[model samples]
Target chain A: MTMYVVGHKIPDSDSICGAIALAYLKNQIDEPAIASRLGELSPETAFILDKFGFEAPEFKESYAGENVYIVDHSELTQAPDDIAQATIVGIVDHHKLGDLTTSTPLECWIRPVGCSNTIIKMMYDFHNVEIPKDIAGIMMCAILSDTVIFKSPTCTTADIKCVEALAEIAGIEDYKALGMEMFKVKSAVEGTPVRDLVMRDFKDFNMNGNKVGIGQLEVIDLAVFDDIKAELAADIAAMKNEGERHTMMLLLTDIMKEGSEVLVISEDDTLIERAYGKAPTDGKVWLDGVLSRKKQVVPPLQDAFA
Target chain B: MTMYVVGHKIPDSDSICGAIALAYLKNQIDEPAIASRLGELSPETAFILDKFGFEAPEFKESYAGENVYIVDHSELTQAPDDIAQATIVGIVDHHKLGDLTTSTPLECWIRPVGCSNTIIKMMYDFHNVEIPKDIAGIMMCAILSDTVIFKSPTCTTADIKCVEALAEIAGIEDYKALGMEMFKVKSAVEGTPVRDLVMRDFKDFNMNGNKVGIGQLEVIDLAVFDDIKAELAADIAAMKNEGERHTMMLLLTDIMKEGSEVLVISEDDTLIERAYGKAPTDGKVWLDGVLSRKKQVVPPLQDAFA
Candidate 1:
């Protein structure tokens, strides 16, 4: 009767918090489920867990459970290595179906919302399960992080509604200020190795048969990228040399300004111009009001590359 | 905006009723949507519609609309030709993802229920919309047809709950007798061309690069297959000559007996044996207690072919 509820590898705040919130709701209904993580915790997620006085969910590197319920992602590649052999009982995600299949029918809930946490909140409201204040806080933080405080294009009416209710339940009055605090923890670049900073928020993509990647970091001030652009470029070059991707773009997003500056290294230099409708000057360009990757960044890149 | 709501190309009772019932609910909620069909109606669906004092939804041969919402099925092969250019605003389905990608995030609700009508009923309940008797009758028929009157393995508690409520709304005190009436229309083979009878409920599948198909008919007796097995074998052989499928099967399902007799035609004879764990004598075999194609027939064939 034990079910392991987990999210994607290279865990973001939404994926991590979604697992926790969904497991809580499932357990309230007497479905024996435990929240777990697949990959390393991002700084913002770690910060949210610490503030809530909750330990991080156990890290399940390998899945050995009889029943597994995936949250926040449906990609088999992002799941446990032996997921193909395991019994997948359910999936709750907001991303594209990455060609995942089951030997039998299972419970699948995929919505087109800004964050998976929004769906989890709706599930809570649907079943009349009262969410705990700490769970509400983290869920709100995850929604705020994924939606960039409702400034991203992916935000919907459901997300905004859930955010308002969850913020009240979390005893938070100003969500914008909470969003700023989360970004402050995420965007702080303190003399860390350029390689570590680039890979922290990195995600790989397969664009028209070529491997590509984008790494984004949010900051209050946009000057963070200007400080170490050269060293970061060197690290990206080393990564490109590994043949993992043909293109690599590092995004330094200014959360306060609600915009992003993208630094690029690509053989197809015109791709960024075609995707954003502006040419990159000196291997860097500013995309106005481009704050979400799944909504704004990856889709256009996929189109241009295709 | 006029949104054309339609089902898959091979329209089943669930697909037809789901489109009609969903369109009714959406219009009540102030969304301008029309229930349309992609293919001709099956006899059982037409019977249900006629019994409910409703006309068959207008046939939509080609899509020329701005917004389209799909139900019952998710495959692009079952969608309109212009679906690639159209904006898919919402989807309420109960099947696997068919690799359809939209340019942006949109509303999607996919569950592993027995029928799409079950999900639509839940949506109605979620919105607190009362179901009309006509709509309830068709929805009940859809649930009964797809789940084989609650005898199929895909049936769940949620489905059973919906059926009970809908039966009361439809003024049916005895659903088993009503199911027999529907299946009497479905299984009526009086002088019907074997090709038409087989193709009436046929659905094609791609199993690991191999073309496969299944057709089912609900009858009161499994012995009826012995009369027309030769004609069915010839028509299916011609179907194979058309290069559509490597394996084609006709399931003579007895709703009362709760079993089926499969008349199969395959170039690979061992495949049928391996899929069902026994050889077919004279091109037919009685599969005791086998009712659901999605749950029983397709999965094993997918495994055998894969």
Candidate 2:
């Protein structure tokens, strides 16, 4: 048996769904392939899998034991397996390579498109595979999620083609309507804890010899901002007090506004002023039309740091 | 500004990433298009975006408030503001159709590939659009997810063509290695809760006048099953005691084995025996080379029920 272990780190629907579908495909070809997950799934992802009658992936943190194949997360540091035993025979990813090195000869497919799911979709298409309805739903979901329902700057033509084909199999139409329904379920604010509300999927970044923690909260109703701003302020202050090295930023993005209300909480008001060109008193800085953090916030912060 | 909301539902990387790419394409054609997320992202998805330094989607649950240019997940349930006010010009998806009524003439694109991300990639190829690296990463991720790293049954020829083109742009080779790495991550078990392990993404079905709750767990080390079996049994028993209407069934799928260990837990032992031809004593039932529930298990169960 040709035994191979495959997985994606910090798995989403695409990673999970792709792993499952590919494992199925490999088995069909009589290759012993296993699909694994590097992290826990979100509740929404769980809901999606349940709706489609699929299971969540098995969680594996690192590829330590057997032959390892990497997916979307390309950093070699994330996967520290014995490179000698683990000959990286293939790679399927949709991200710019950060720092990945393979000692063995491997087939690497890194496409600058929308999602790695698109590549998996294309592969299936090339092979003329007949996707089951449940797996088809997963492919459709992965495309919708990564492309922001075809709205992000990172999307590609291949992404659209894959979605069109998967849509036909999954029996879905009016992606906008389905997207709306799914988003409504996700953006619901009922019975959610305030801490959970403020600190979902937070990330830490270094800027100007200081580490900054950033958190994003998506809100369907802008009115929720009024109820949560003070609580969010306290949460930011607490994080700063808890020995966080640098400034803290919270982005409350109003989906309806198509913009974000940037809140920067820092001990050094000058640093906040330096980044945003306005000093914020009481540990608060609000900026309008600041949705793309990479394009808008990160660049300005990097410039200020420089 | 003429704004058109474009989106997909329960989206994966391809849907969201494709939306972004297509939105960019539309903008280049002088159409003001905004990409939106229909649901929350999974962890793997967040990792993909973070690696490429792209923003998470602006969450929009519905297109009821504005004019929508549909993408991956379009199904006509609720009408948007005005079909006349906004020309429903373009559509791109990969799922099966579900009642899309558009009176205005539109460019409809629904392909039978694995993902819409593939479509977007093909569009870039068709239009000779220069794919940015970030977009490439997103689209590749979408393909990997949707096609299960090229192992799904739902793939087509167009999907392959797009991925091949995208591979050149992203500077990657050996997709199989990458897919293996991703799947390996899914099999590692660390801090996952027992309840989560037992009940993760379970689904329900009707079989022989009985409600059957079927759950699947992917595992790399079969040795882990020895440790987890007792806990799984207890969890199953607890669920049975909860007065739910279903007989709970769990399948511990050994992806490498291309088989599963079926565990049937129910008050009705006769039903278990009737389904699998034997009552699983000591809480374990072994099945040889039974991996896919849809292909291998569901059919037998359906026949037994009939």
Candidate topping DockQ: 1
DockQ of all predictions against the true structure, Cα-based: 0.47, 0.01
- Candidate 1 is graded, for docking, as acceptable
Evaluated at residue B188, the lDDT of candidate 1 is 76
Q: Which residue ranges in model 2 land beyond 4 Å of their true spot?
A: A1-10, A25-31, A76-91, A126-130, A204-212, A236-247, A266-306, B1-306
* Interface C-alpha RMSD, model 1: 2.5
Against the true structure, what is model 2's DockQ?
A: 0.01
Highest-TM-score candidate: 1
Q: How many residue pairs clash (N, CA or C atoms closer than 3 angstroms) in each of the candidate models, in the order given?
A: 0, 175
Report the lDDT tens digits of candidate 1 across residue range B86-174.
Answer: 77877787765555656555666777888889999988987889999999999999999888888888888888999999999999899
Error of 2 at A170 (Å): 1.1
| lDDT against true structure, model 1 | 0.83
The best candidate by lDDT is: 1
